[model samples]
Target chain A: MSWFGNSEPEPPSGPSPMDLAKQEVDMYSDLFTKMSGLCFKKCVVKMHGESDLNVGEMSCVDRCVSKYMEAQEKVGVILKRAEESLAAQQGGVGGPAAGGVPGVPGR
Target chain B: MTPVQQQDFLQHLESQQRKDSLAMYNNLVFRCFDECSKSFRSKRLDDGETKCINVCAEKFIKLTSRVALRFQDIQQQKAKDEAAGVQR
Candidate 1:
């Protein structure tokens, strides 16, 4: 009845390294989709006769993409902290602290 | 590591990746909404909205860092109590 030594063969714990890479690619694809949808909604309220984006619309999409990347970078920092905390909780050890990066308010 | 152990680790990592992706998606949607997409009348972001997006991202980062710092303090306290108890 022991968990680790159960007679039954355990299932694969998770995807292989290759599979992990594939998942990363998939995630990027999803990001692209989300970005396109958001940018379109923000920058293309009306469909003009021309397929090309106007100057204003072009600038908007550019700004949208830039902002998205900025948000993602911020999210990355928070995500690392989240993972560290989760690991610490599970393993009972000291967790990571913020590096106190300057320009990051709420210091 | 044994094959079983390796598999277990991989599974844990997979789940972690899933959680991370979900979090990113949610943050992007909410933060972007707050920054841009204010008026549907125009199909473009104004200068103010663009600036808002930058500030919004920075604010969210700060907020999470604050929470993480709090968690770290609590963990240190727990570790300290455990150490003190051992001395008794």
Candidate 2:
């Protein structure tokens, strides 16, 4: 999904938008896989006890998803703030080559 | 650079990002497992171990966020010093 959604100011200059979408899907799956494993580790701990998810495990998974998303949100905030601060420090010149802004060269 | 080179560069970046994320995921697993896992006498996890792992994951994420903020502050200060040195 587009992080900016519909509010994107302009098309980003890179691999086509379709590639970006694909990247997003890859990222989502990565997140889902991690969350699934975490919840399994947390809730479905007792594999030998019951073959099916117990009432508590079911609800634990439910809260696990929500709480995982919240954790993602918190982390995203920190990352965004860090990116913004870095960009500002480098005088708004940020990208793959986010070195300090270079002095203008005479042609 | 040529279009082919640009595409290659972008592809490299995407690949690097995937590597980075995977490294991070591995880190979480390592940390939570180290902090939570005690005994492997049985294949099943007990209630206490499960709770420990759950809390460990949450705290690990929170810890990273705290570090990110601290890192950003240090970077900002370093940047300011660099600018000052340039002026001097």
Candidate 3:
């Protein structure tokens, strides 16, 4: 799917583009599993009188997923800001102090 | 980026992704079982239990896709920035 912003249509050297695509799918699948699991824990109550999720629970989960992802982005921004400041303090742009942060979903 | 560094990052992502998928699997099974399995009178799932589990799975899948789309949008933005040579 032209992942990683690699717009060049380069021929395969080692790993095929299919391999990279699989990795990309794996990344998103894991993200979905982890994020939804967490949001379920947060939004769903242990006690349920009916088999179906109530309207409130459903809406809460909907909001929870969006907010959870947004929180990640917001935290990413703060993390970037902190890293940038640390880099400036170290007298360089994105010096060693600015790295080591893990990639978010899809990098 | 160098091949070694690229490999390291990909390994990191793979390991973390595996861990997250496993954790979610265990959590999903445990919680759904706990919530849906109420009676021990039979070895089979009752109607209510089956229905509850179905609903639970359906809801979980729904939530996952919803978050996935949101996540895709964010990642697409990041991809565009990276494509523009804005290194993160």
**Between 2 and 3, whose lDDT is larger?**
3
Q: Please write out the lDDT profile of model 1 over residues A1-107, one tens digit for every residue.
A: 01112112323653344444334434544555566556655665443234345577666666776676567658777876676678678794543432222112221
Give per-residue CA lDDT, model 3, range A9-49, as digits (tens): 43555444445544655655665676777877777764434
Models ranked on lDDT = 3, 2, 1
Supply the TM-score for candidate 2.
Answer: 0.47
When summed lDDT is taken over every stretch of 10 residues in candidate 3 chain A, the lowest stretch is: A97-106
Q: Is candidate 1 or candidate 3 better by lDDT?
A: 3
| Share of reference contacts found in each model | 0.00, 0.00, 0.23
> What i-RMS does each candidate reach, in Å?
15.9, 13.3, 5.8
For A1-107, candidate 2 gives per-residue lDDT tens digits of 22213212325654554444445545654665566656656765542333345577666766776677667756766666666687778887654222111111111
- Each prediction's TM-score versus the true structure: 0.40, 0.47, 0.52
Q: Model 1: how far is A98 from its true place, Å?
A: 21
The best candidate in terms of lDDT = 3
lDDT of 1 by residue, B2-64 (tens): 697577656766776687557766765575665466786677777666665655444444333
Q: Residue A76's C-alpha lDDT in candidate 3?
A: 68
